[model samples]
Structures are given as C-alpha cells and as structure tokens.
Target: MVFGYFSNKRREKMLQQLSDSRPNLTRAEYVNRLVKKGFNKHQAEIVHDVIREFIQMDNFSIYPEDDIHKIYAVEDLDDVELIDVICKKLNLREVVQEDIDELDKTLKIFNAEYILTLTNHISV
Candidate 1:
C-alpha cells in the first residue's frame, strides 16, 4: 500500500542518518571499544548482535552512544518483541512484565550502552 511505501522510505532515510552519525568500525573494533568500556567480550558481542538485528544497519556504524529511540521510533517499535529477542539471545530468563516496565522507563533517550546495563540486571 501507499502507506507502507512511505513508511519504508522514511525508515531508509532514518537509517542512513543514523549510520552517518558514527564512526564505521569493524566488528572487532566495536567489540574492543566495548571491552575497553568494561563490558566483557560476550556482552559486547550480544549487544552488537541485538542492535544489528533490530536496526537492520551495519553494526560497524552503530556506536554505544547511538540513541536507540532515534534510530527506531518508540511508537513504531514492538517493545515486547525487542525485549524478548534480547533476553533469548542473551540467554537471560524470559521477558516478564517487570522487564517490560523497566524497558519503558529507560526508553527515553536510551542508547546502545543502556542495553548492556539492562542485560546485566536481568538474570541469566
């Protein structure tokens, strides 16, 4: 439908903007940067994978500081699905209402680094 076309076009533009805002590091570089910031290698990789999965953008161009809310509009995103995927991929316990509520609280100006923090609080 016409609405779908426009929505896709808008999404593509937003993705380009997001990509242009960050340094294009290789996956290894991204992981290293995260490790330097104190995330373990496994945590860094999981965060990268989650962002790459949700944003459909090259992880190389996505940095820890990137605002997730800007990259994907909150209203348009399925928070439950996102949280579920993160939990599943991270081998954390299944998503619960508290997890959803916690995510909602952090949704404002949330960045990639916050994902790492969130996972830390959620049980494995």
Candidate 2:
C-alpha cells in the first residue's frame, strides 16, 4: 500500500502497524482518528488514496472530495481543479456509505454541511 501520506518514516511505520492490527476499521474511521491524533489531512489522504486504488476496478479518473458534494469546487490547483486533484491524487469519484451506520459516522466526522456543499454539484 502507498503510505504516501506520511513523510516521516516513523509515522508511516506506526500507521502501517495500526493498519495491520485493525483490518476491520473503516477508512474514514481510521483516517479521522489519525487526523485527531496529529495526522494532517494529507497524511489521512494517503491511507484513502491507496485504498481507493486497491478498490477501484473501473479506472475512474474523477473522484469527489466529500460524501455529499460529489461536485467538488476546483480552486485552481494548476491545470486540474479540486475534483481533478481528487482524481489524480486519490482516483475516487465517490465517498461510499458502505452501510447506513458507517455513512452516518463518517458524515459526523467530516461535517455533513461541508460534504453537502462540496458534493452539491455532483450527480448520480
């Protein structure tokens, strides 16, 4: 897996160990806790990024940034915008619910309002 989120070898090792120990934790759960424990968003992203690659069988290039707003506003990250950043960095098009409980849990962690705003432009 691409532990690209951690630049520090020590932190990456810690994250890898945790991943090994907790194979059942949802991605958002692990990621949210990691952020709470001082892992920045970029670091959390690495975990999701690699996992997305692992699960993405269709090679979809456009992944939305939040559970609600599939329509991510691109704030000019060079040639590619926010959605493009999500695609290039994470290769995701959706933040799946997996289950109702999991969906609610992630929504709380990520903030439902922000997710709604970001995903507002997206379609089914």
Candidate 3:
C-alpha cells in the first residue's frame, strides 16, 4: 500500500511538471511578435534567425561573465548590456551610462527600444 501511494504521488508530480511547461511556438509566431514590437518584417526575420542560432549554440550565453545565471529571454537581458554587446558586435555608436538625470533619460529611451527588440515572446 505504501509503495502504491508513493508511485501515485510520483505520477502526479510528473503530470504537474508536464502541465507547467510552456508550449513551443512556431517561427512565424515568433516573427509576428517581433514585428508587433516595431521591427519590420525583414528585420524581424533576421533577428529571429539570429536569436534562434544564438540559442542553439553549444556555448551561447548572454552573460558570459556570469556562469551561474544565463539569459534565455529578452527580459533576462538588461538594456545597457544588450545595447553594449550589440554595438560592439556591429560596430555601432558607443553608449555611455551616467548617473545624472540626462543620462538616466537617455538610458531609459535606449532600454525601451532595446528591450523590445531583443526579447521574443518565446522561451529559449
């Protein structure tokens, strides 16, 4: 009887885990999400492919400096970090962070756009 009870509990736990898992999304759906966030269809598609490939890489990590926690979604990435990395990778304009009011405002604007651009609705 005890064994049976434990087995039933294990089964229930497994079922719960399965139900809690998020469903996988189609590529089109992911692209649509990016488009809605202000990216043109072409840009969205390109970004989608980039993100997909990045996630699939064996050693792909948003936060390479930190091994304990890695970013898998847009939310996991900070705007400053995202913009900094992207700028460096693409040779874009450099961004500076300041604690003053003007700098804070500039960072806010960049964050608003960068967050939407880097983040897809799907979990990596």
Winning candidate number (lDDT): 1
By lDDT, the better pick of 1 and 3 is: 1
Task: Provide the global lDDT of candidate 2 against the true structure.
Answer: 0.40
Q: Which candidate order results from sorting by TM-score in descending order?
A: 1, 3, 2
Better of 1 and 2 by lDDT: 1
| Model 1 misplaced regions, further than 4 Å | 58-60, 74-77, 100-107
Tens digits of per-residue lDDT for model 2, 3-55: 64443455445445544554454566646755665544663566455435543
lDDT of each: 0.70, 0.40, 0.42
Candidate 2 TM-score, C-alpha based: 0.26
Task: Write the residue-wise lDDT of candidate 1 on 26-81 in tens digits.
Answer: 77887888788787788788777777777665533766666766666544356456
Off by over 4 Å in 3: 1-20, 57-70, 73-124
- Weakest 10 consecutive residues, lDDT, candidate 2? 70-79
Candidate that would win on TM-score: 1
Candidate 3 C-alpha lDDT tens digits along 1-124: 9998997577556544543564444567766765676665654455445454544433322221111112342343443454455444444455544322334443333332343333321112
Clashes of each: 0, 9, 0
Query: Candidate 3: how large is its RMSD?
Result: 11.8
TM-score of each: 0.72, 0.26, 0.37
Error of 2 at 45 (Å): 16
